[model samples]
Target: MIEYVPVIESPCMSLCVMDEASGWCLGCGRTLDEIARWGQTDQADRDAVMAALPARMERLEGKAL
Candidate 1:
């Protein structure tokens, strides 16, 4: 059994924007699809996405806005 945990914090810094080559955000470390579909996603799905953050941030290559 899995316990559903609501995301207490969002990476969004009000700098919502997406890069052309990658679906990643320029401000927060999330993809446009992820942000858009967040409302409809289940806790498990959100967890899966959260688990991928490190890799996604790595792909960002330390770029800051």
Candidate 2:
């Protein structure tokens, strides 16, 4: 038997607030475009975007990545 696991995990932290200046979600660290495209994007593209999220979070928080 094989165990099933999700390929991509959503970053939504449930804050659901967008900052006007940066255009990034305060909770998930994803841009509006990214969020909108997430469901349609392929696995590789999704992975690439997910890879950048941590850096986005750092930038939004004014911290060094």
Candidate 3:
């Protein structure tokens, strides 16, 4: 029998711009280290990062206003 493993997709928006002040990617809201280790990270860890993105983006947007 084969075991099923789910794939955790990356959140890259192709913007690839890093905000020097926060150290987060403007497009995906991921830190440099998070982006670097994404492929090697497990599902739970990836999910945790994904969970944090919305708030990060919201904060970034708030800063823009």
Q: CA lDDT, every prediction? A: 0.75, 0.84, 0.92
Q: Which 10 successive residues of model 1 have the least lDDT summed?
A: 56-65
In the predicted model 1, the residue pairs found to clash are none
**How should the candidates be ordered by lDDT, best one leading?**
3, 2, 1
TM-score of each: 0.65, 0.75, 0.85
User: Per-residue alpha-carbon lDDT of model 1 for 1-65, expressed as tens digits?
Assistant: 99996655566778777866778876666887889888787778777888887777777765543
Root-mean-square deviation of candidate 1: 5.6
What value does the lDDT take at residue 64 in candidate 3?
83
Clashing pairs in 3: none
Evaluate model 3: give its lDDT. Answer: 0.92
Indicate the TM-score of model 3: 0.85
The superposed Cα distance between candidate 1 and the true structure at residue 27, in angstroms, equals: 2.0
Local accuracy of candidate 3 as per-residue lDDT tens digits, 1-65: 99997776989999999888899899999999999999898889999999999999998878789
